[model samples]
Target chain A: AQTVTQSQPEMSVQEAETVTLSCTYDTSENNYYLFWYKQPPSRQMILVIRQEAYKQQNATENRFSVNFQKAAKSFSLKISDSQLGDTAMYFCAFNMNRDDKIIFGKGTRLHILP
Target chain B: NAGVTQTPKFRILKIGQSMTLQCTQDMNHNYMYWYRQDPGMGLKLIYYSVGAGITDKGEVPNGYNVSRSTTEDFPLRLELAAPSQTSVYFCASRPRQGDYGYTFGSGTRLTVV
Candidate 1:
């Protein structure tokens, strides 16, 4: 069984600043996928960014990027130039390369302050 | 495109009542999943289907049942509803093998009183 952990239950960042949400997981599979999903008040889950374990270079999408340390079992999400729309419940998820099941973390409620 | 659609955006049920949460996808995805999200918490998988006529249990399948009659439709049924069953349910679909992310529905807010 794989478990994803987001230590921070809640975090706040000032507008136009950068913020990082920490995530760690326990998995024995050599190849897997890590993802960060955002859910706003609308309760719609939106994919933020994803990282493949085999890739050494971190994945960057617009202002969202990930710091994946496979050896340390850590995958953190970084939001640069944060905006108010970035405020949401962020979840870290994990799934094996061949598995259809995705394990999710408790989530961190992020608030972007203006 | 209506990627994923879940009916009855909000539903309330009494104890011992039974109801089905309808989910349908237009992407013709082979993999579909049902998950529940408690207030201020993350999501827990209830069940999943790899394709039509194939379904399996997930982390939290108790008090729930699911049937996959087609590649685009996966419905979750709850029998004898309890207060503990009150949560937001989500349906998602994705390709069996791909780097693509799952497309989630807006979710159904279910309240069991």
Candidate 2:
């Protein structure tokens, strides 16, 4: 069985500050993928970033980046220069390279305070 | 382009009633999925399809049915709505069978009384 865990249920940081959301997963498969998704109040799931287990280099998109440690089975999301719009529920996700299912973590409610 | 579209943004069903949650994708994706999101429970896969006419049960498929008659459409049917079925439902699609590039639709909030 595969599972993703987001340790933090909620977090708050001042705008322009950097915040990191922690995530860890338990999976026996060596080949897999990790993803971070953002769900705003509108109930839309937006893909923030993704990383391949085989890739040693972390994935970065604008102010969003992932620290993917395959051996530790840890994948975390860091939001730099966070803005008010960055406030939302962030979820860490996992999927096997060959499997059709994508598992998701509980989620961390992030608040960017001005 | 409309990445993924789910109809009936909100619905309320009485116990024992039945309804279909519609989902469609214009991206010509080969894969589609239906999942339910509960508070503090990320998302549970209810049903998924590899392509048109190819549907399968997922992690939590009980009390739910699905059909994919066309590549672009995957609708989930609830035979008998129950209080436990109240939650937000999401539809997603991707172009390939691989686990990446999933586009999610704005979820439908369903409440069964």
Q: Model 1 Cα displacement at B42 (Å)? A: 0.8
Instruction: Tell me how far the alpha carbon of residue B42 in candidate 2 is from the true structure, in angstroms, after superposition.
Output: 1.0
**Per-residue lDDT tens digits of candidate 2, residues A5-92?**
9999999999999999999999999888889999987879999998988899999999999998888999999999999999999989
User: Considering only the true interface residues, what is the Cα RMSD of candidate 1 after superposition?
Assistant: 1.4
lDDT for A76 (candidate 1): 96
DockQ of each: 0.66, 0.69
**Per-model C-alpha lDDT, please?**
0.93, 0.92
Cα error of candidate 2 at position A46, Å:
0.2
lDDT of 1 by residue, B1-113 (tens): 88999998999999999999999999989999999999998998999999999999998999999999888899999999999999999999998743667889999999988
Q: What stretches of model 1 exceed 4 Å from their correct place?
A: none
Fnat, one value per model = 0.51, 0.62
> A13, model 2: CA deviation in Å?
1.1
- Number of the top-ranking candidate, with TM-score as the measure: 1
List clashing residue pairs in candidate 1. none
Candidate 2 Cα errors over 4 Å, as ranges: none
Per-candidate TM equals 0.97, 0.96
